[model samples]
Structure formats: structure tokens, C-alpha cells
Target: MGLLIIRLITFLNSQAPETTNYHIAMTMLANYSNLHLISIGKIAKLCNVSKSTISKFARQLGFDDYLDLKDNAAFIENRFNNPLNYLSNILTSIETDGFDNYLNAVTTDINFLRVNLDFDAVDNIAKAINDYDNVAAFGLVFSESAAIDMQYKLAYNGKFIRTFQDDVIQEDFLRNAGEDTLIIILTNSGDYLTKQQIKLGTPRKDIFSKTKAKIVVISSNPVVKNFSFVDEALIFPHQTKYQTHSIMYQIITDLIVSRYRYFNSLL
Candidate 1:
């Protein structure tokens, strides 16, 4: 991987890709792909380029598609997963501006969610979670904790929510799922890579293939347009070195539960 990255850097220095955004995107891919899990859409948004332009940049790098580039990035990310190192990195950010910056960052993100998120779309997603015969939250590590949080919050309301961490258990949940099941998946990318090193989805296939389980994805990264088979995706802002994805996921979970209760009150 080091050799490949060195060669990639050399190529970027020499060839000078189509646009400045390409250069920025490739440089990020070369250095921090492992540390920061980002989607093409996030890079595009960060670079102020179109998604197609990002795809074009990947092709310039010899990948077959943008997803391939992202998968390669995930493969690289797999090696750098570290708990204490990550925690230290996040801590360093606190020194930059202290509690005020911390509070502002989180508040800004929540306001961004309130302004940009579609409540009707959220209502549709909440309705699915509320109306489903069975609901399962699937993820690993930090993401798994978010799933557990969702279950604990809703189970008090009499929702039969199941949360899974073990692969064996998740497979059982999926195999038995059907039109009645709603699966909430947590990950930066649907590729399901994480610091815990657990891969939940099958290679080259979306999870939940065996049944008609409705999928609601609350992603830590940018979700590209028209993600097939996914009924809903609530995207979190791209994590800076210090940011946490679960913060945004928690906000969404709160809104979903609150929305559910609000509607039930009308009944």
C-alpha cells in the first residue's frame, strides 16, 4: 500500500489531473483515505465539483468507477484503525478553541440538520420504522452502540426492536426478515468498514438480499444519489479529524422517535 501510494503521489505530481479539484481529491485519497472515511459526494461537495467530476477523477486514477475508488479507500482505512490514536486526535481538536468551539460545532451541525433535512422524508422513514412488523438495527462497534441506543429508546414505547453485533446473530436476523422487517444500518459507507474490523455486508452485494427488509441507512459519510435498494439515507456531515459521526446519527434517532410519538398523540 505504501508503494502504491508513493507511485500515486508521483503520478499526481506529474500528470496534473483535469482540474484543481481532482488534485485536491486525489491528494486526500492518497494521504487520509485510511484515517477519514469519505464518500465521493463529500469530496465533490468539499471541492465544489460535480459528482461526475469526482468519478472522472477516479477514472484518471485507473479505477473502474467511483465506488471502486471508495472501496479502495476503505481497504486502506482498514489498516489504520486505532482507538487511542483516534481519541487523541479528537482531543487535540479541543485545544484549538476550547468548549466554545466544541459547542458551536455541534450546534452548527444540528442547525444544518434542521435546515437541510427533509422532515417529510424523515416522516416517511419514521413511519416505516413505526409500521414495520419487526425492526432490527445492524452495525458494528461504535455504530453498533448507536443501534443499541435506538433500541433502548424505542423499546420503552413497546417497539419490538432487535439490535445485533455478532455476525452469526445478524445473519439469523436477516435470514428470518421479510416484508415486515425494517433494518437500520450504520456505517460511514455502506461498505461497512469500521475501527472494530467487522464486515457485515456480503462482498459485492447489499445486505438483506434474502428478504424484503426495508433499509433505513443513517450514514456517517456523504450518501451518493440514488443508492439502490436503500429506501432512506440520512447523511451526516463529513467528519473532520476531531468529529464524531454518532452525534448526527443520535440527532436523527431522536427526531425519528419524537416524530413517532407526535403522530401517535394525534390518534
Candidate 2:
């Protein structure tokens, strides 16, 4: 975690002098976990700067852009309440202990999941699906289970949905996706298959480009905002470092499924 903090500090230091608002940005980054639901525009405004300036600040930090910086900050902030002191604890835990370290990690993971529960996101997801005809769910590894779970729930409600786990299969599905298909992606890192799609550089941004079929991303990493193709994003907090299971993802999926089911009943 010292490495993470050092990397973050180095990135902040690299920002342009004119765009340097390191103090305010650091304050915001430090408090990011508490302000999980806050909008980027709001953060910029709070920093007394334009959104583009904030973006530049993020770029200076060696991030691909503002969203990347925000996401990374949020991930690090979520790991510990006190960003400054958390690094020492993290490193110490790594050296002196095993079972105690495991327990702390589990506790952190559970807390992260418990803290992030946004009803507004669930409502938006349900509304988006209600307006679309077909839904395509995509993810890899842990997220694969999330995508499949979403597909199952949607299918049970009589919605046309497909789940894609393999990158090749996912790309093919996206390429052939209809105009009325919504792409739902579940990822914690947001670096796996989705990054591959971006690398492909398809003119078919239209796959996630349409208003009719919008893209909704659920990720712990804030990098979801980097996808111009994505229309909406829901960020989950990164749970403990040790536990592989994602309770927040499961809960968010459940909320989305329940919302869609209820909406369908009304129709």
C-alpha cells in the first residue's frame, strides 16, 4: 500500500503547475470513500475549477485521464478510512502476521461492501432496461458470475438477455448486437475484457452508442467513466484484499434484478 500511495503522490506531483490543485485534490481523494456518490462535476466545482482543468490535473498525475485518477483514488481511499495511516498498517500487516492479517482483510472487505449501497443506481438500471428490448451482460472471472446472474434474472422476467464470458464471444456478441440491445458490464477492476474492446478500436462504438440500448457498467474501479460508449456507471467499493467474493456486486445485482422484476410486474 506504500507503493500505491507513492504512485498516487508521484502522479499528483507530475500535474502541470497551472493545473496543480494538489491540496484540494488530495483532500477530495482522501475523502473519496465518504463521497462515493458525489458527481465529478460537483467535485470540480467544489475545487473551484472547471471540469476540464480537473481532467488535466488527473492527466498530470500519469492517469489516462480524470476518471482514472478518481477511480484509483477511490479504490485506495476505500481500503482505509485514514488514507495517510492506512499504508503503514497495510505494510505492517503484510510483514508481522498471517491470521490476524487475514481477519483484518476480511473485515475491511465486508465494510467496503456494506458502505456502498446506492438505491438511485438500481432505479436507473431498472428504468434503462424497461426502455430497451434486449440486454447483453458481460464480465470476466468474478464478474462473469455477476453478468450471468443478471442474465438469469432478466430471463426469468421474460426479458431477452445474453451473458458473455469469453472475450472473443463477447466481442462477437457486441459486433452483432442489435440497436435495441443494452450492454450491462460487471467488473471490479474494469481492466480485463473491456480494455480489450477499447484496444480493438471499433467504429462500432454504436454497440454501446445508442440511446435506445444504453450501456450500464458496474465496477469497483472508477475507470468505467473512461468508456465513452458507456452511458451510465455504478461504482462498487473494493472489498477486503484477501477475500475473493464480492458481496457489493452481488447486492447491487440483486437490487437491479429486483427493481426490474417489480417494474415488469407493473407493466
Candidate that would win on TM-score: 1
Error of 1 at 89 (Å): 5.0
Model 2 lDDT tens row, 67-91: 6655544344324333323334455
Worst window of 10 by summed lDDT in candidate 2: 197-206
The sequence of per-residue lDDT tens digits that candidate 1 reaches over residues 1-267 is 222243245346555478675466575654554413677777777667788987776676555766765565543332444432334445666776686776777777777777887677668767887777678887755677788898988877767688854544566676678877888887755555222233213345344455578877777565522566677877766424445666877878888888877765665
Candidate 1, residue 97: the lDDT equals 63
Error of 1 at 191 (Å): 2.8
Residue pairs whose backbone atoms clash in candidate 1: none
**Alpha-carbon TM-score of each model against the true structure:** 0.58, 0.53
> How accurate locally, in lDDT, is each candidate?
0.64, 0.63
Clashing pairs in 2: 11-61, 109-240
Candidate 1 wrongly placed segments (more than 4 Å): 1-85, 95-102, 193-206, 222-225, 239-241
